[model samples]
Target: MSIRHITLAALATLAAAQSASAYELDYSIDLLVPAAWPTSVVLLNVNPSDWASSTRRGAIEDAADAFLLNPSWFFIEPLEDDDSSIGPNNENELTFTSNSALLCGSSACTHLWYSGTDIVEADIYIKNDTYSVGNTKSDNLAYAGSYRSLQTLILHELGHMAGLMDEDGNYSVMGQDWNVLHAGSTDVSPYLDADSGAGLRELYGTRVGFADLSVSHWGYGGSSGGFSTHERNIVEDTSGVEPWHTTIGGEPYYVLGAGEIYRFEATLENKSDTAYTVDVSIVISPDPIITGADTELVRIPGIALSPGPTEVWLPALVPEGTTGLYYIGAIIDAGGDVPEWDETNNGQYLVAAFSW
Candidate 1:
């Protein structure tokens, strides 16, 4: 229990205290949970923060319970791992634990819940609020508005714990801000989709079996009124497909190619007030084919192009005799990075896919 606190705190502090982010997790991810996962996730996390108060503790607990209790998508494990008020280990201040029923790669999966800390929920971290983006400056949170704001915020955070994102969430709860977490700004459901999960896998540098490759469902880009506009609609008008409606229901532009690299000649257009962010990545299916002798996967990653036609491609140069066909497509980054799931169900996110 003690190590949990020390490690996370040290990591959080390390992440927060630093003026510049020395670490950049290629940040890929995988989905241990399936899309619209029907099963419930039990809260085995330990919180050091005094949760006795109805405010913060109740807020978090209610958020966690209410979120998991929801019958909509995935459910939370009913049996919580609240074994100890204080963990056995002094260093593990906050820990994440799960039952054998929900085991993943190893004990690390459950260990995160067993750790000790103020809070521990299923969620990822961005630049530490106190660390990476040093000064705490938020325009939305502090703003004078609705009473549901705090509750919404908690739900959003819990959603991240429940595997949701607002797209780096630039402006929402699931984003770089407050982790900027949100499901989708569009008709977009605020759930992480499959493509995004695959993106996470690629980013994490962990290759999983195609059978293990389950992604969350996401929407396309577009206006609230036109969230469901299909890819065919976006590319139908022109013979070669122009940038018109590229922004789809108008949020979350697709990643045409790997970022910080070749600028894939893809474009989009939309008139929705909702904005979309653009990113690129590659996902390799397990059964990679190599014409030569190398046993490594040899193929191109899928490119997500938002607001329209799904085009799959391959690398121009193959070191030797390596070739294979893989599933490729431009998923709209509606709620998550790769549009696997739309947390808010805002169909405005135009996700189009193609398989090579």
Candidate 2:
């Protein structure tokens, strides 16, 4: 059964607002109902002969495999080839299409058939004639010209099948801009960012037997660019500048002036089925690893974190006359309120150069 559809303009507007956190779940036309696959494992049928070349088929397979890298509870497996069609025939199929109408002037599109909130089928169709599809590792700039990365496109479409909406502004695999797959565009892995993984985990659940509450990283987002955790000086133009001011021995460092406040964001991941009301502490330490023994700068308490990823924007204030090269970091569950499988990963810190 086909559910009602939302207008693209309304969807784009909603996506823009949620871009601060970098992931959105697909909703019905009225935005009243959200949809996701009911099961943890989704099976798809593929035909090797559907592609003109073996590499093309390999690209599709590679895309599906990329999802396995995430900590989400979902799994995608390939079934034996059968006479599959690109419709709501109870078959999830990945194939090519030359129909311009189906493509909608884009390189590819995914159609999902859902009953109420449960997605029963999904069909991914790639425009075989309008674009040249291949592996992105060979050439990421292919999108700049005529070629497109089949793997990247499929990876994004699979996100749709998993009930993730198209994300804008954030550097995500589900980004509307295909150039995000290009090399050197984003610091995070191109296959799946923390945002996408967090979305998946939110939809389904965290993998069984894995309970981790971690500070994924500290970064900032800009109007022109996506979130980044790299080290770079804060300048007038924040377009390409990273969150930290410098880096030492591969560790990020934030240089702060006395009595100055800086705004930054952190990605927190809850790899457990239970939601937690936790506290996040911003601390300063002489050592690279942050701990409760360090000087506490600020404590953000009572953060409601559901399963998956949550992005929080925080302010860091440099105390008067504070001068030293220390580590400025965030410790999730700083009060140890939540029991996790690995407590060591809850803290993530960056070097801080505090100058008077």
Candidate 3:
């Protein structure tokens, strides 16, 4: 997923803050806590009259989708004390100054007063217009927290709630991998990639909560050609080979031939809310005609993927010295059961032939 931010552009939209960062663009953040439960944390959700005009619902929708994608880490709850009365956009206007955490910067983040004294009285904000904060009370999208497939603006704001600032934290959702993390404009939405989602799963999955084991697969017709043929770079789908699903418990049975480059593809859907470690492998079938042993194998790295559609690239993976039919498989590493335990090997698999 590509994270799109727009801080340098908030000017045209009329989003202006009273802080020293009045001219920067927009930015946003996410807070992961685990187990789909939102604690009694407090933060401000401001629209400032023209909010609907300046911000697109889609940006908020994407953020909501992320929260729904993983519920264990976040839950949108109500404010325990709105009675304290903090001014709408002032760094100093406030209550909840005890257990609360503030997300501010530019015009988007007006100010924050927290009640959690230990959180450290530090002032951190999105620094631009393109940034966003959590919705301890944001009711913009009613469809959030239903499923990962759904979207939410609150989650985007929570990222900000969790210090998703300027992309500098070690495991921050606001990290610099995005080109727009700088303090130059007002960006309404930014996205965290599949890899980042996985990282967050690992980071908050344990501390927050775990999810059920689920799976989804999508593939086109045989090598000869069908629905998704062109998408696979499958120049010509073999006429006789029909479509097939890999065994959930069997050892991989795919092969690759010498001098031939193979392209392996698969469609995956994250059935559960937690993150997933999706990977693929190319196995060489040890044949008497082939000189070397099948011992040499090609495996995918720590993919760090989430529960969604992802394509694994295996270019020219097999060396020329070896020639034979092989099986290629996508594996979902052990550990699907609760308590973070490993499960029997479960994944998507396919077979193919490589040639000179």
The number of residue pairs in model 3 that clash at the backbone is 81
Please say which candidate is ahead in TM-score: 1 or 3. 3
Runs of candidate 2 with Cα error greater than 4 angstroms are 1-19, 29-33, 129-138, 142-146, 177-190, 209-356
Q: For all the candidates, what are their Cα RMSDs to the real structure?
A: 20.4, 11.8, 18.7
Residue 107, candidate 2: Cα error in Å is 0.8
Candidate lDDT scores, in order, read: 0.26, 0.60, 0.30
Best by TM-score: 2
In angstroms, the error of model 1 at 308 is 15
| Candidate 2 C-alpha lDDT tens digits along 1-356 | 01111221111111112234557788773376568888999987774466435666666666777666565778787554567455778888877777877776677888888788889998877777532344332343322344456666778888888898876545456764344331221122235445677788778876766556776442223334322222121211123234346544333356666665554456666656667888787777776566788787777667777665566654456567788776567788988887676676666653345564
Candidates 2 and 3: which is better by TM-score? 2
The residue ranges of model 1 lying beyond 4 angstroms of the native Cα positions read 1-39, 45-49, 65-72, 77-142, 145-160, 163-166, 169-172, 176-356
Compose the digit string of candidate 1's lDDT tens values, residues 326-352.
222222232244332212222221223
Ranked by lDDT, top first: 2, 3, 1
Worst 10 residues of 1 by lDDT: 12-21
TM-score of each: 0.26, 0.53, 0.33
1-356 per-residue lDDT for model 3 (tens digits): 01111211111111011111101112222233222112323333323222243343333444545444342353322222323333433322212122223443122342323443212112222322332232211221211211111112233334444333232212122332221110101111233322234434433453345443221122222222111121121211223232333322111233334544444443333324556653333344433111122332444434444442243333224456765444344334323323322122133333444443
